[model samples]
Target: MLIGEVARHSGVSTRMLRHYDALGLVRPTGRTAGGYREYSADDVRRIFHVESLRSLGLSLQQIGRALEDPAFTPSALVGDLIRWTEDRLAREQELLERLRAIDASAPGDWQDVLRTVELMRELDSTSAARRQQAVLARPEGESVPAELLAGAVLAESDPHVAGALRWALARSGGDGVAALAAGLRSEDAGIRRRAVLAIAEMPEAPGAVAVLGDALGDPDPTVRGHAALALGRQGVAAAVPTLVGMVVEGSHDVDAAEVLGTLSQDPERADRITTALAGELAAPTADSATRIRLIQALVELAGTSGPEILRRLAHDDDRVVALVASALLRVLEERSRTNRADEDS
Candidate 1:
């Protein structure tokens, strides 16, 4: 087989085969009668071997050493190839994501595309302050795409930067709700927590309420707590149980109680809220602290049954619970009298 025949049969270009010969990677075994490079069967097999190794990302020099050096081991070189391939793949994936985000922004021109790319770079900066400024410094009329903001919001670990990102997302009028909603289903609890926090601030965002409602069942208590508090403020009665549990468990109990108090303004919800608090106080597991917190929450309720519940607790065996209940009972009574007088007037 002459060089031309080898190039045709083995698919290696003649120029490349000559280069391979010069490099001593695949020398032909003999010369043809016409003085063209002659490749025997072994040379053709060697050419195939060289092509196969090249497919695995081997450098020409490395392939030369691999074929020529008896002591050259493949394990370390193969491992290196794997790492290089992984790094390339990761870079490609990041570029793909960046392009997708930019496309999602729906830029009007190349300038808009450049600006969006710049903002994305800033959002990915090592300095949290720079990331925050990137979000805060966005021009008033220039809209940063909600998809970009949502992606930043989910990945940001800095509390301050995260807050700015959420604000920008909210300003996008909930366009990012679907993206943030995707974060809610993340297997990473931290991501779910961040998603709920961002969604919590966008109460008026389309689908924000429904996303928060779904987050109420999140496995993370922190996630559930944030969702419940946000929902409670929106007058969703489903948050009542979680709010009451917050008061009992002492997790954001003050905010939970305040939201519970606001939710209690609905007369029907007021009954349920009062009943739930009373139930917690009456439970066998109710300790002094839990009972006191429950009692404090009870005072925030706006129903006739509040004072009655407090009165029942005032005679309880726990002195602290009894004292706190007794004091709040007078306050409730005073509030009741004031209401009655104002109504009469």
Candidate 2:
């Protein structure tokens, strides 16, 4: 076939076929009397092969080696192509997310778009201080979309930056709750922990209570602890068990104790909280430190059984438990005496 016929038959443009010939990628086998280039059947097939490789994202140079080099194997080249394609896809995905964030901001003009873009870059900056400043630097009356803050809060690892992001998210008036809720479902425990922490600060946010209730069952103890504390402060009794567990385990036991004390303001829950602490103290697995922590927690409880439980612990077989419980019992009695005196006076 002549060049035009080859172009027509193979769907390869004449100019491209000529360029391929110039690169020695696919040369014509013969020439007519007029000296026009002519392609044999095999040459046409090579053109098709080059096109096939190009479809797989192979560069022209790579395709040349693939077609001409006898030692070239598809394994290594295909693996490299896969990696390159994946990298491109990841970049594209990041760009799409950036665009979505910008659109969600609802910029009013080019200046707004530029400002939003700059803020996003700062949020993604390697400097934690810059990231935190980005969250706090939004000018008064310029509202950032809560979704943006939610995404930042979920990914921020720096404690200060994370706190700033969470603060900004809370100011969004619960608009970020949906995004934070999605973070709760992430396979990454770190992300889930951040999500719950951010959500924990927004108790008044719509659906915040429900999301926190769900997080009570999270496998990550930190996540559960934060959720439980948040719920306990909101007067939700469901958090009593986790709060008690936190005290028993000595994980944020002091804060856990305080929240438990607050929850115990209810007469009914006071009994249950007292019993749970007593049960932990009596468990065979309870160690000296565990018993000490439980005793301290009991001191925070208002139920009548709390002192009696401590009284029994005061004479326990463990000398340290006996000493610690005896000391706490005195403090409790003293505290009671002070309250009674103040009321009487």
Candidate 3:
């Protein structure tokens, strides 16, 4: 067969076939006495195999290596190629995810895609060993373990991995969701903290919400803060009442302020939250530090409620009052320029 016949049969262009031949990636078998290149049925079969592997997204180097040994049959090479293809597909998915995450943060740019592809490759490879471990164990049970999944999730620095883990947990069944939520209930404070952070990004399950509520009373104020913050992000309105009820009832003023900061997004919820926090701020037992936090939440929550709350906080002897007041004015001023973001839409 001629090179053109082989190219036509294999779906490769003649130019590409010649280029492949030049690269030693794939080559024709022999030449005619008159210097015409010739190929056989076997050559066509090899070209087809090379084309198939290239279509599978393998590098030319990989295709060449796979075709080197006489003992390596097409079926065997394809089996190996299948595994590579799966990993390649996974990397593509991760790239899409990272691009989504970046686009969420800012506008799309060519640089973002380039950075995302790099990050995606890193994430896909990082979790491979842990996924292999999970498959190897099988656990005498159904789906994979959460610890292995957690390892897979934490292996990547990108926020999209967190989102993917959360979605994966939700899809696996209620049990995976339950185990992930249960992580927030871990006795070790550090574990609880990390779990709260991870699960916060996870889908908000009722089980997870319940665990977060329990964690709100964690001995470490940081844990309580994380729990409240997670609940805010998860935003089950049912959790809103619990977060608010804890504010007037406890001394985790910083944590309470954070909850109020988030809940302030809802007018009805903000009124209830600030009303309770106001009482805490006014009481004789409240410290100057706690008062600072309470005032900050009031400032953050002050939509139409701004001047009234600002007047009260302006009286505080603490110098931070001035800084907080300045921040408020700055936010309003910056809005004049950056707030025009809607215009670009």
Q: Find the candidate with the highest TM-score and give its number.
A: 1
Q: Quantify all predictions' global Cα lDDT against the true fold.
A: 0.90, 0.92, 0.61
Best by lDDT: 2
- Candidate scoring better on TM-score of 1 and 3: 1
lDDT (0-100) at residue 340 of candidate 2? 97
Models sorted by TM-score, best on top = 1, 2, 3
Which ranking of candidates, highest lDDT first? 2, 1, 3
Candidate 1 structure quality by residue, lDDT tens digits, 203-269: 8788999999998898898999999999998999999888998999999999999999999999999
| C-alpha lDDT of candidate 2 relative to the true structure | 0.92
Clashing pairs in 3: none
Q: After superposition, how far is residue 194 of candidate 2 from its true place, in Å?
A: 2.7
Worst ten in a row by lDDT for model 3 = 132-141
Residues 177-209, model 2: lDDT tens digits? 888999999999999999999999999898999
Each candidate's TM vs. the true structure?
Answer: 0.88, 0.87, 0.42
Name the lDDT value of residue 3 in candidate 2: 95
RMSD of each: 2.6, 2.8, 20.3
TM-score for candidate 2, please give it. Answer: 0.87
Comparing 1 and 2 on lDDT, the stronger one: 2
